[model samples]
Target: MNTREFKDMDLSAYFIGPKGENADIFKELTEKLINEHIGYRQNFNAEDANSISEFEKTTPEFTNAVTNMKETLNELSRKMRSGSIPWTTAGRYLAHMDNETLMPAILAYNYAILWNGNGVAWAGSPVSTLMEEEVGQDLAHLNGYNENGWGYVATDGTIANISALWMTRNVASIPFAVKAVCPELVSDKSDWELQNLSIKECLDLLDKTGDKKNEVKAQSARSGKNLQKLGKWLVPSTMHYSWQKALDITGIGEDNLVVLPVDEHYRVDTKKLEEIIQENADNHIPILGVVAVVGSTEEGAVDHVDKFVEIRDKFREQGVDFAIHVDAAYGGYGRTVYLDENNNFIPYKDLKDTFKEYDIFTENNQFLKEDVYNAYKAIGNTDSCTIDPHKVGYIPYNAGGLAIADTRMKDTLTYYAPYAFQEGVAVPASIGQFTLEGSKATGSAAAVWTVDRMIPLNISGYGRLIARTLFAARKFHDFFNGQKFEVNGKTIISYTVYDPDYNMIDWVYKEEGNNSLKSMNDLTQAFSAYTSSAKGGNLYNLDIITSDSNFSPATYGDAPVKFIESLGISGDEYYKEDKLQILRASTMSPWVYDEKSFNYWAPRIKKAIQGKLELISTNENIL
Candidate 1:
């Protein structure tokens, strides 16, 4: 994958069409799928009588049913076309964490659904189950995991996070279980020490049980008996809401979750985290794990994962440890930016040279800042991570993934469902037994597998696509920084909430002399109607489509305080209103970086903002 070869590649071939440009390509592929399905049916028992006889084909009842189905499908398609968001159009859709899915993924999903295979077990979906395994390995490798690691697809990142928490909870109890079941295995450790053993040490103790592993596992927290011994879980305030649900569902009450405040950049405060860990250790309070977010949902902040690894190692020297899990649902695939064609991580010093060689980031290298690069590099050292294919992998919905650094961690969450697997089948044949979901759809697996096969998960593949989005976000941030709008002789200033760590940029606006946070929130909220697809407004009357979010002291603690002051709002006003509103743009589309697209849309966006400001000035309720 040389720069010339990558530049020469046709990016349009990967997308169906913005306006049916690739309709013929899609039609041809669909015909092939239909023909293959017909061949499969014809090859099986060709001599047998037809399931639907020729006489039935002529019946008016059947004819009416087919006609009714066609009419219903047409009606549904009409409604969808009118109501749905135009996510496929790169220029219009800047909202949310969605964009155009890859053509191979769409086609593969359609092809796989003809069989409706269930990925729960090999007995039910032999071919697709194996494909799921391969997809797992692909994701594992994409996130810096090697042969010793193992991964699997889940329903979504919520499920993946919950499963990781479940595994951590159960694994944490293993040392205590071993102490009770086989005293000699953990004889050198006291009860207090057993409760505080690191995740790896606990897994090692389980391995020591060998023949009695199942019995020891039964005595662990999975049996719902030792839940109290599993200790507290720590996560940043920037963590996804799913972490709360994960804690709640896994029997680790939300009260036990310690939410650390983020720094000015919205990243977790490592100093506070270290202090908490040291305090917990001194008090003998067992700590189960710490979650680091690679891409947070609200601000798209990348936590200092490298700092986390260093903290863990620092405490490990003092005989204190906990598991580290990364919630990278939105930014996991960005790791490809640092990987070569062979999937090896590029050294930090050579990263610029590599990008130059690949003809990417040639104009601006700030997209790969030192902090962001090191954070991605440290992901391999974490115990586990949650990644979503639909978010960053450019695949269709219902595909989330989990990767564990060690394959042996699978033993902690294993179950037995006799009907799902055959007696002689081996490990992966019984994958359902180790998963949180049952009867998972093979379409998602097939879609992911197809995309990975067509587009490798390395620098030459996903890296190129992701790099463009990074550049787009940086440009958007730069475009809005210090921009001003004049209305009614009052100056309205525009500011990005923070420098983007990935592709999401949050923009805020406030009158130059106005220090009222509520007024700012109202103005920004009013402006959102223009850029959003809200009902009661003209859907097409927009310069761009963007999402909106709120930051407040309640959920984020003091994270918004500094940002609020920078916007000329006082701390008293911030606390009084309790919220700050901003427009969010997720520039996941690669086309946004093109010079023509940028030049065309950027001014329109500015015009739209100016129009909103003039409208607000005339409206008495807004000021």
Candidate 2:
């Protein structure tokens, strides 16, 4: 589509369905449901009690509560006015929140809320329980796990991550438990030696433990034992805060969580990962597992999953292997790039043109980049994954997912409460038995299921939406790095974008000067003048996220700090503060798909950058 015409494209078409047919059908279905189920519960034969409204009138306390609620809502409405993040304003956003959702999801959630269904079990929410099962299947297929695999929804990425790690810790210990109890199955092998054993070997050893096969089938319950035999976990430095909680809750002590170094792109260093595994092995610490972040919380960096698997395979050859869990809470759905409507792999050549057409064409595009593409493609190869539909899937709040490549992994972590799920029962049938949390919201599952039905979890669906968001991010990156301001044919200010990994810079700002805190702070102030609500203006008010780049000599040492200093970028100062602030933009708005809309938004952002630099150069306090 041409830029101007693209601007006019009806994005809601994706939400509402053909000719608004589904929207009308949905409305009609909801009305019918209300008429049958909730259209006045009182029968004509029964005398009516006092209505809730009448009670409010007669009871002062109830009336006061109502008044307080109204007052609070009024205050909230007033505060909401100052909020400037517009979902429709092209791709000028730098926030991780996309603020995009579909009509079906909203409608489905509304439909389910009236019932207030809990998905913990079939008895509580019959329809929603089945819906959740369907949703799990949909999510699994997206990550290349078929019906043979197993997954379910959780409250958020935190719970999903914890669940995945909890499973890993338990599964890692099964071999050790068997070795201690039944030495013949794994002759002379210590628990540490058994940790690296292949899955087949682990299962054989489990059989020898004489803990009835039924226990493995339905024993996700926590033993509360500090099974030190599970050993330590390896994770990239860019890990989410939830990992620590996973370690704490799983009884894997904080000291056992070994954080590894990340490469220039903020991805886990594969070489370093191997080194850590070897070092742990040398020390006789049975390695629990390695974590590969599919989409890091900050910077949205993707780790080398493909390389992780390759290294793991090599380790397997040496009788040294460990579970690999992918924390793709943010980026798992980005796997849409690799699949088509039928969940079949699309040829790279075919995808290249579509990527180019979307203006996301770049060497850094994961689908185009061999290593990155393989990383995404290898998601299903991992033991388990955390995928949040609430973030990229555009579903309503509190819907995260955990998918297991091998359904057998669930055998170790299964927990059965007599009151919740009976012992010896399989999950989904007894879904609550397998999860960390009980009493889950079935409405969340309905929302995901309803949306996936309308928006297929494949290339022509969510993939296209994601591609637009990515294009927007790349566009902003290019504009900030490349644009130069000119007045009356005289050269003026320019800005630099920090993309040390891709090296995607114009050097216009670099030639003028290097990046400094003063420059960055000035830029922030000027940008705020245009985009901040207090300024009575709006365009693209960028937000900055800072990270602790500086570390103690033991944690990170002087080498990284020295490297930044070598670039003439004041690394010495940042080293002391333990900060590396970067301007991040999340072009997650689908509206940015239109070139015309993005073009309109892009220029103003450039103007803001140029204007900031000019103001700073003229006066130190002008900002």
Candidate 3:
């Protein structure tokens, strides 16, 4: 390693058990959990109660339960060990799901599950409620939120996304409702006035209209006018399927979803987004909201969030008002770029060393560009943001979160259950009154809190882990893109690794005199798609473990044709069966950055491609 380059990686913190004491930690957590359970049970005298343990001493049911549990546990262990998907930490395969997690998080989660704490309200689980609140505050701060901001954990990214949209939908409709019943409240108001009313103002207007909160909710449930008839939701083509579902659930029909085309880099085209917004306005359709993705699902592209903010502000200056929601489910925590050792945001000048440390500025200047930097920095200004701790946080599954820039956004959606919120407890202290989920797991909150405590959400912690993953991606890209094979000193095949926005690498074979495969249409007709085995036990059979992305006509609706044309290639004919299957590799595994591990795996990746090409060249009916 060159001394001139930056070096600040604390390699020990990268693993689950840095000191190799996983066994001791697991044992300690297990014992503590049992003791806590016993302590709770001891509240009622043992002599007065015939508990399960006592009954089990005399009955066969306890034995039966243990027997069944042991058998199931054994099978679970067997299946997990034999699975094709690489386990976390080994770092061979990466198509989502990182292989490393903090030991504290796991231990804390195990301890919490013993109590089965339901984070519905204070009365239900007081400890978990506090932990959940801390977790929310931590996430809010991590994702660029401030004192005025608020956030909560949900089941996953989809739920978090829908929850944000739900709030946006209801909040946006309040002004129109107020105007309809109490005309005086909005008679002389401008467009921004009608659209940008605070939740309290809208609620006060509803009260002035002689309507109860429940009555307003009831009317909304019964339906007044569909959101599609009201406005359009502008989204990019690279959007996750969750947005489509969000529309349906929010009563905004999917047809009203204005799909913006992606640029060559796969980021949303701001020019087209502006055009569509203006076009919709001219047609008397309001722009309901604009969703900017911080990490696109397929290509990991980060949209220019600052550009979205600028566009919104430009429209706002002209009396147009709309909300911007950033879906950062996959890349929310990547904002670690802004934080320093003390978790304070540093200026761009200071970020250069961080970039240099990961070697990110070498080829992909996109990551360090001003627009990209501002995009991440602008997260604090968005109306709402959806982030999943499971994806990049290395937390256990099913931990998605939604953060609102203003806590007032939650007021309109509040619902209090008579039994849930006990006496003497305030609404703000408990979350059941506002969240979409009712009976949520407190264990998830514990896991996030414990892990984040150990690995603070700063340059020295979460930032370090994420930097390694990104470095692995850069490394994999270099290796995959540099491959040109020869058998017996004769060049047989080469590859064209499609440029990715992040860690996802898509590559296609480049064959000599393959002019017939000039376009995706021609290639699909010639080569049959590769299919994986159904049973799954084999992972390393192919020197490289990769999946395929088939850009066929049926799947993309002519987008593939346009994409191929943009590549300076020609395919005169168009066929529904026209498919362009590209091999994909995701370097989400941080372990790949380890030189020894990467050196061992790099040649295998090449061998996999070379072996496939050799077979194709020699066989007659290989397709």
Candidate 4:
């Protein structure tokens, strides 16, 4: 695709419409979906007697019930319309990780629901099970996984994260299980060496056991023993809360989770991470795994996975190894921005020319920093990753994905259900055996499959959408950084928390010549609450809605010290109160990329802030 083609592409065609502009197109496709399913049912066993007669269809009781259903549906639609966030609108919604789902995904989900296919078992969903597998393969490919890798959809990112932890714990125990079941297989290796085996090494040992694989797994962590041998899991403070939940669920006690501090930019300080890993090794404590976040939930920071790979390799040379998993639920799809039409990763040197060819970025606004680019490129080298289709793939809900670098990882967590597979099948066409979830809706899988088919995951497709969001984020970041307001004779200046690594912008307001961190936190909190719908503020009165988050000394561990001090806040004041509040804006709406829309909304957003500041100055109780 060329720049002109990208510019001319009708992004509006992909949505039902912000104002019903594409309603006719959506209706036509929806009717086609219903008719196609009905036609298939009518064609099957045509010679057999009909289940329902014409008389039954015309019954007054049935007719009345159908009318009541339509009326109830109308009432529900009205309620939803009145209560839902206007996510599809460009300037109205800049909060959270959600956006308007792509039209293809929505329609495909609706179409598949009519059949009610269960993805857990091939017996329950012969057709959709295969489709789900294909969707998994597509995700694996999108994440740059090689041919030996595999992936599958989970309920959501939370489930995916838990599954990764569970797999890691079980795989960590395989060497112990092998030593017990087949002593000869590991007679030369000591317990310490076996405990330190890499994920691949453990799987290789399991393969050598062949028929005894089951016996070995019976003694593994999944069987509820040898868990302590798995040692500690390392994660940055910016990690999602799901990691904590994963620890609780996997029986890897929360105390076993080592929380590393983030650097000034909110990325895991790799130097500190290395020191901790080395300390663990020197202390003879076994290590389970390390999680690197591709996009932190609060700050949109990208941890350096490339640095992680280098550290892992350096340790592996000294007989130390640990699995590396990337939690990319929010930024995985952004990898498309670095890929070519053929899905090959575009080298950093060539990216400038490519951007020029696509007319996507301004000369001064190359959003792909060297660290972020290298982090994304290193995804394929990791053990596994959690990618949410709902977050960045623009797919509907209930479509989170887990991509494994090696397909053998599946065996570590596999379980067989007697009733879910066929007797003669060599490899059962089902996902239940290898997943954390059972009886999942295949409609979510269909939604992913449909979107991947209609819009490729490469630069020509998803990349286009991602590029627009990045552009919008950069513009917003520049706009806010340059903005200032005078209210009640106090000059207020805005500063971004950090230059965005992705599409989210975290910013705060500080009063001129004011060094109090508490006052700054108060002002930002009041501004956020004034513009928020959840704070009992009227949405219609605001020009934009944004989310709010806090950073505290307890949770962030001195990470906010530099950011707080940058605003001239006294270090003593920060230590005294120890909290920083900021407003977060997620620029996932492509419409904000339009110059006219940006111009219209930017001024109004400033006016809203000025109004809030004026109101807060008058009401000391607002804080």
Candidate 5:
């Protein structure tokens, strides 16, 4: 786990990736777009794609959308690089990106390897590559990871969560699996020994659960090395759906996954989680790693890390074994700036007072911040965690991260070579190596470094920036809550500081006659978009946006754009069902400062809502 043992940790030396071996792949992609984007665009391809047929034929959207998306992306990239984009831009997708290094990072990454697939490792991403251990160590140190841990960088939060889960299932179950099916080999006859296995392992041994025999056979089939261990993984019901996805990949039935309930604040009910762990403990239902969330997706809910550590301690005291995986994708980076009413990290006790002002929402969700985020003051123990620079760190899109508390977990899951294992990798930088992913990109690492330059991952810097966003959230909450709008039912601008986990001041304007997801989505979208539109009325658009998409038709088409839209939310959307359009606000931009930003934008949002009401009231036939 020490740097000397992992001496070759630097991946920047020879070549970024597979290119050290083969370089042509890099040439082809660059050649495809070379001489394309050196300066500001004076001209653009006419919107008419039919005129130029070839460009429209193969991956038609690839050329058109790719060009458009990249153009806008590059613009935003330049602003982010310069710290010139207003805080308003942070919550919305705009022409301005985070930083210019984003381009160099991508170009260098693409220069390093030609990846058109999954990004699991060097073997899979020969063209993409492994990063230097030394650099990764720096990342570890930044996140306050334990001194001697080794880890891999995943493509996104979902992948990172899956990787952590897989590691959890494997390390916890493998040894138990070996013992379960061959129980006769053991000399120990104590009842406590049997309880040490997974529910599946213990069931396989007892033929106990309803379908005992079938369970045994299924587990036996899954035991062929690939799935030697899997049973119940204790995670919050509030966990990301990806945990279910990980279940499918591991061949462990999702039915076996235990979802511990969440508290009023939407945090995992750590107490309930422990009861289940203790209940199953003596029964041999091995409690796999306990996955806690530092920043949950639904409400920005943060699982109490300190409480989780306490659970870890109690479980260990009970002689039970499990790892703790912290899903801090949304909130991890905030750990550094978790200050007192003032800011400081050295005297770091639970300085929960700094968050006192935000706690007003906990009563009626009428305030800016809440007590929940303050709970962050208590964090300590962790096994592994997910951190995304793309999120709170404000790096450009597609940059997520993972940091494990226990560096030893890397050793538990590492792949080695038959001959001398290189100090860095026993794995190679070509396809079909030891990875669940296929291709890779080093651009992410470069971007991580670039943004860290702008905002350090310590308590003072990054935490301060994130705190501003929360202030913006609270400001928007107050503005929306106090204002009068035309919705029939109670107009709830839900940035109920009660849940600091929530990003948008979800103004659930239930139109008097209809408040279904579809109706709500339509109305809310209209309210947010029109208010946020630069062309709307008096508002300058300031590049700030925050609004969510409706999931009512219960389909997935607009979920992603809807989520992205909420970031600095507001934009046009092509609704497939009714072909209706509406405006909305995402209210997550820090540019929503005191006098200048809010004064200009809030009135515009109100006016937009009024205009929409007039439309709804006038169109009785449509309703």
Candidate 6:
């Protein structure tokens, strides 16, 4: 108690609940956790009708993903209470399925309609494929794609990103196809022609030319009549390492990815992006596309989607054929309901009302200056994008998603069944075609459908709930901004302010405002990420609780929007940030609402940070 230099952490009662048997304690607890914690879920607030009450009546039969896993854990907990089943290996004693930690996944299994096939088709349970289609639709709509279109929900963001890269490569070939082919005519013997004729053949023609970049360039102008055009993709430096991974995955050289620097806010530097495009093309590399972010994991920053779109259009006039892919895997669900419904984000010029249109009414429903912010749905206007329901969507784990803005882009990523095999198929992008993945997550599809059913994708509902989390983020940010804690910590960016050009908070050192505030954040985070007994959770991301309302994403959507808008994002370009390690107080859990529960559980986090800091501050035996 004497060494507790960080005073802003008054969460003394948090880890332990108030001493009472009242059921109200639990309800209050859920609210505080929902609004205050910032770890998981679509958000603290419910965003729609279905969202409000997906499970109104929990069967003593367990509802939560973690709860289901704990059914076995509870048995062990009971055994532990009885001193029977001792802690064995955090180990092989459990299997992936029968393992004690399979609860949340099991919860998802029940909803999946239990399809075990590669999930490759209609025969695998027509219902299952139907659900997948619905899940894809939800993802597309949530990430700002057409509401009723074709997209895919896959195993992970890696696969999703890879798929987009595949589409990107195919589309890039369309404009460059002619120029890339003819130079290989010398090597275009019978064996080579038979082995490769399709785009893969053209790409392999890369090896045929042996000239590397020039062969690819010659392929661009195969007829040798004109200079070829191959463009670079401008991406935020804060983007996922996956963008680089895609370069390798699609045979696109790493050198072709034009990385743009970020401003203090972690958004792509617009001026730099324009400069890189013009510079690279001048150096003989046409800019291929722009891949903005919806939710970057490193800093949880949603890039300004609207701004990038403007840049995309301006560059396209030069015949740049710019494709935008939004990496929103961690933040796709930020805008659940469609409050800014008019889709004002399009045409790129009407982003001015972004703050007011998505603003949430505070205490008296009266709008506050602090209450205005940008929207996420408005920020992800990409040719394609990917999102994960497992992370922020509040669904159980493993339900990552991929959504493409242009419906036809799906065709570019597809594999034609030799025209002979798929002779009768109407759609070129069949379930099993085009994708790098073979078997997919059926349970994930079910989970997405079930959750979306609970929370309709309109703004008056789930969108409102999304807004609430923004409120919590701002509350947490404001709380730390003014307080001069004893520890040294820094600002961690999360949420979009809704303004196409503004809204993201910078995470690196901000020396101008307050010097003491920086040290406190540093001190707080130092201890927060430490491990005691060398066991338990680590503070890996900046933690902030939106409010109990954010936890209600499972309930009807109403209030999450205001909070979301305040973070300042739009549907065109996602704000991205570095993967700075920090503690995240997740309100995605419904356990953090009222004063009573706040008294019990909140303090543990504070204590944990303090205790870890103390451990680090002392050399012990060395001292």
In order of listing, the candidates' clash counts read 0, 7, 1, 0, 56, 146
RMSD of each: 2.2, 6.1, 5.1, 2.5, 13.3, 15.9
Q: What TM-score does candidate 2 reach?
A: 0.81
Model 4 agreement with the true structure over 1-623: per-residue lDDT tens digits = 32344334566688886676789999999999899999989999989789989999899998999999999999999887666666677676777888788898999998998897577888888777888889888888888896777889899999999999988888889988888889999999987798789888989999999888888988988878878878899998998999999999999989899998988788999999999999999998878999999888898889999999999999989888899999999989889889887779999988888877766674444677988999999998899999999898888889999998888888888777788854347764678888999898888999998888767787767887888888888888889884788877778898888899999899988888888787888888887776677552545445567789988777787787887777777766766887778899888886776566689778876776777778777865533
Candidates in order, TM-scores: namely 0.96, 0.81, 0.84, 0.95, 0.61, 0.60
Ten-residue region with minimum lDDT total, candidate 1: 1-10
Full-model lDDT for every candidate: 0.84, 0.65, 0.66, 0.84, 0.49, 0.47
What shift in Å separates residue 73 of candidate 3 from its native position after superposition? Answer: 3.0
Candidate whose TM-score is highest: 1
Which number leads on lDDT? 4
* lDDT tens digits by residue: candidate 5, 375-466: 45444346667776666655545666666655544433444443323435545432212234434456565456544443445533454455
Candidate 6 lDDT score at position 91: 14
- Candidate 5 Cα lDDT to native: 0.49
- Candidate 3 C-alpha lDDT tens digits along 14-82: 355423445665676668878878788777576675545666666787788888999999999988756
Prediction 1 global C-alpha lDDT: 0.84
**Model 2: per-residue lDDT, tens digit, 124-237?**
777888888878777777787775677888899999988888777766666555544454666777555776775545655566656555543333224554367677888877
Q: Give the Å shift of residue 250 in candidate 5.
A: 1.6
Q: Report how far off residue 64 is in candidate 2 (Å).
A: 8.1
C-alpha RMSD between model 3 and the true structure: 5.1
Candidate 6 weakest lDDT stretch, 10 residues: 90-99
State the TM-score for model 4.
0.95
